[model samples]
Target: MGSEQLFGSIPPNWEYKTLGKACAEGGGDIQTGPFGSQLHASDYVPVGIPSIMPQNIGDNRIIEDGIARVSLEDAQRLSRYRVRVGDIVYSRRGDVEKRALVRNHEDGWLCGTGCLRVRVGEKNVDSRYASYYLGHPNVREWIVRHAHGATMPNLNTSILAACPFLVPPLPEQRAIAHILGTLDDKIELNRKQNETLEAMARALFKAWFVDFEPVRAVGAQFIAPDIAPDSMDTRNPGAINRAPTHWPPHILDLFPDRLVDSELGEIPEGWEVVALGELVEAVKGRSYKSEELVESETALVTLKSFARGGGYRSDGLKPFAGTYKAEQVVHPGEVVIACTDVTQAAEVIGRPAIVRSSTRYRRLVASLDTLIVRPKDFRITKAFLYFLGGTEAFVSHTYAHTTGTTVLHLGRDAVPSFTFAKPPAQLVQKFDALAAPVLERIQATEQESETLAQLRDTLLPKLISGELRIKDAEAFLKGRGL
Candidate 1:
């Protein structure tokens, strides 16, 4: 397999072939299986046979999560349409670029109308190899160019059958699949680990803040007089004092005083109510001229870049033509609020980030969509403030005040006017100090996830194409012990 002797310089041993030639006798079959509307919402059971759809197909992978399910009776009726293990499913309707390699034998079930399953005949070519080839940049470009319909792009059976492929021998195909699979495996592992870490952090946040368990314990201890000081130990718990309410001999007395009001609701005594604008600097992102944008390695912060999860995406980011001023910069730690869309209102919106680094495109600067809060005279810690802003109450207020039909706009004037009960500075600082490490870990994990995604994106095009051979990739990984 001399690399120089290959077709298009793709390795001599590898032969250039069309997908139609490698498939079963009849041309690649493209047919819609069953309609989704036939399955009623009431009939949707939690755990059952999964109904594969275009949405299930990701970047050379199948997403089982959020998959629709159907009854066994429906599955029997569509038995002939069932996909087998090793079948490569291509999306025919929406998001035509998505494809998946059915690695697990269990996924051999009926797929939705939007997807067509490709079953290779008894040939030396590897299914995984075919999946990667079809998902490659060159093949994808051809598909995109040839796809018909302006409203929705599609790849019919004819187009797919005629699509060319760079066919490597069975051994080589297996080797290539193995090499690429290793990298993907590592990526998936990291993603899962991060998910677990995130879940742990969320659970801790819930226990400490949302449930107010710690505060409740503190409050309980403060009000209970019948419980001995040793029995009220913070570390190991003792029997709780069971004094009658009218008897007035419980820990409630020691708890901090609180006030209930119609306007601001219930709050700790001595806490002040103030508008969000009073506490932080609220600013909108800049709008750059169309021509000013360029593709570069720079990280551009945009509203679309922010995901529902508290992180920024680099995908589809464009560079700024001119140098951005410091004012236009979004420092690592500043809180960013999404002010434009009220529908997505304040979910991940109004969230703050402790900026760890600098970014570009200052002109298309951070938007007023985000209300940046820098601590002022108040005792509220930045971390605590972020958590508060993320609360349902704050989001509801933002949603209520949002104006405009097409694009829901939460104006600057409206933001600053929204108020919340502010706890004493000392208490706020204490909570912030306790919560800082947790928040920092969340930020770090997010950054790590971004880096991993970037690495995968960088390797995808080269690996998918014959430009980088599997042997070379394996050598690279072995050398790095990755």
Candidate 2:
């Protein structure tokens, strides 16, 4: 059914208006971003104002990962292209329906190349409401249907300006935005918190296993194995000593005191250089025909499932209609590594990602391009191994072993042969004990965010089309403790 049919009977006080009419009444305009002549490739610098390209535009948010930047001088010259808070930026070419609302922090960033900016007058229409309305399936369909170009769908100023818009009273618009924004705010908070939690876990792994900070403190002889270095007072002339204090004495006692020579380097005494195979085994996934990919409850975790640096993304899940071995099936919290990479930078290949639960799929299987890493011994936990896989040494090792031109492939023995300085069993367990809860918290927070996102998405179309009243939605949220 068309959007016109989706919004059948208009509610009382609701006004049907085109985007152009709404903008004209509010003194707003839909303008294309800076042209290629205005901003050249050479203008991009390592540090300066962020230039939000089409890729940066995500679902109602700007994805800052690998975003382009420009010099201050260039940004100043293209000041008119600068986005303001409450502005909506859309991709001008492919995926033209998707847009990102500019937040306070991104106010001055440029509406970069291959992009279009929709500035709505705050006094006439709530930009937040406009963003959510645009995200509605019906409205998105309209944009996609109207976008020109057979090869690549493109959105021009006139195309967007002439797009139909459903407008509510200014007060009603704000209320609807608030309800949806509340859920979005919580989701964003969880995302940020997860980033911090992962960073903390990675930092601890680097300190104990990679840097061997605890062993160094022991080697310095500044404090006894049974005592924390912080217990010593620098104020006392005789007690002045240099040692790390991050680890508690009980935890610190787990490390060996002296450095020993190894093929890899000088590692802590008693810590052995061990192959990854000693701790875990890598199981390759199933290869399916294109015809076997379909809309099903079972999803195939493909190369796209892994984020650029490292982490799982549910959006990469593809519904599958193929058969797979029991070993190919993966669950939430399981670790998986990409076996192939198509990126020029080799960003995905050899990188590890923890699989996340999917609301849409009941079962998940690893694709041929991925390998499920499972613990085969008690020496290492999944948490420890996941972090270990993220180490620079591990990534470089896999990268070096990859063979191919455009599509890099990791050798079958690449994972097993990769070596690392293995810490003691007790230390590994202790690290897991500390790190597991942090990861669990992150996962739980992510799951909650996913649920909130679903709720927000479900409420969006109904609220925007006047099929569901604001008061009723508020009541529903209140009942759910949202």
Candidate whose TM-score is highest:
2
Estimate, for each residue in 186-289, the C-alpha lDDT of model 1 and write its tens digit.
76665555444334334333433344333445554433223232222222222223322221234223324434452676554455777767777665666666
Angstrom error of the Cα, residue 138, model 1: value is 1.9
Candidate 2 per-residue lDDT, tens place, 1-482, comes to 11243377878898777887788788888999999999999989999999999878877999898888998899999999999999999999989989999999998999999999998876689999999999999889889998999989999998888888888999999999999999999899788867766766786788788878778877785433322334333123123233344557786689888889999999998888989998897999999899999999899999989887778888888899999999999989999999998746577789999898888999999999899999997799999989999999999999999999988999999899999888889988888877787778877888888799889999999999988999999999999998
Q: Candidate 2: which pairs clash? A: none
Error of 2 at 232 (Å): 23
Candidate 1 residues lying further than 4 Å off, grouped into runs, are 1-7, 20-58, 61-94, 100-125, 150-152, 220-274, 296-299, 308-310, 322-326, 339-378, 394-421, 445-465
Computed on alpha carbons, the lDDT of every model, listed in order, comes to: 0.59, 0.86
Q: Which ten residues in a row have the lowest lDDT in candidate 1?
A: 229-238
Best prediction by lDDT:
2
TM-score of 1: 0.71
Worst 10 residues of 2 by lDDT: 231-240
- Which ranges of candidate 2 are over 4 A from the true structure? 1-6, 221-246, 341-346, 402-413
